[model samples]
Target: MREISLAEMPGLLGQEVGVSDWITVDQTMIDLFADATQDHQFIHVDPVRAAESPFGGTIAHGFLTLSLLSAMNFESIPKIREQTVGINYGFDRIRFVSPVRSGSRVRGRFTLADCRFRGAGMLMTTYDVAVEIENERKPALTASWITIVQFDPKDRPEGV
Candidate 1:
């Protein structure tokens, strides 16, 4: 991950920040996610049954795809030099644009959409993110993700 000063964050608004390495959405992953979420719908876990559906085969759950953003963010988003901790603040919006078929690959593209000081030692940042399916025109999902970063007051950068 890239490291940047607090002063440089504002300059990144509306700009693409990073793209993550591709992650394969194979049957094992889909099955594991289904087990974890207890979503045993045929389209997500039963390959034979799903093969008869419009999707033609099993697909990863939308939430499973969404959950991957954490790993993606860690791989791609920049680190604030003064940040001591970062927390997920949840999404303002999310859309599952398309289904991700089993054995497909996906990656995340992130853009810095907003950044603001939330408190003396905390910053609120929002990112517009998309999970792109390999070789597919439409993304698996798109979301507006918010996160909070905290740092020691004494470590804050000069000039806001």
Candidate 2:
């Protein structure tokens, strides 16, 4: 991940930050996600049954795709030089625009949308994120993702 000073945060707003490496969403991953979430609908876990559905085959759960943003962010977003940790604040808007079929690959494209000081030691950032499916025109999902970065005031850069 790239490292940046607090003073540089403002300049990144509305700029594309980074794109994550592609990740395969195969049957095993789909099955594991289903087991973890208890969402065993045929379209997500049963290939034979799902093959007859409108999707034509098993597809990943929307929540499963949404949850992937954490890993994607870690791999793509820049790190604040003074930040000690970052935590998910929640999403503002989320849309599952396309289904992720089994064995498909997906990656995240992130743009810094907004940033503000939430408190003395906390910074709130909003990112416009899209999960693109490999070789597909439409993205699997899009969202306004928010996160909070916690840092010590003493470590903050001058004029930040």
Which structure among the candidates has the greatest TM-score? Answer: 1
Q: Give candidate 2 misplaced runs (Cα > 4 Å).
A: 157-160
Residue lDDT tens for model 2, 1-160: 6899787898899999989999999999999999998999999999999999999999999999999999999998888898999999999999999999999999999999999976678889999999999999999999999999899977665665
Give the worst 10-residue stretch by lDDT in candidate 2: 151-160
13 Cα displacement, candidate 1 (Å):
1.0
TM-score of 2: 0.96
**lDDT for model 2, on a 0 to 1 scale?**
0.92
lDDT by candidate, in order shown? 0.94, 0.92
By lDDT, the best candidate is: 1
- Error of model 2, residue 111, in angstroms: 0.4
Worst 10-residue lDDT window for candidate 1 reads 151-160
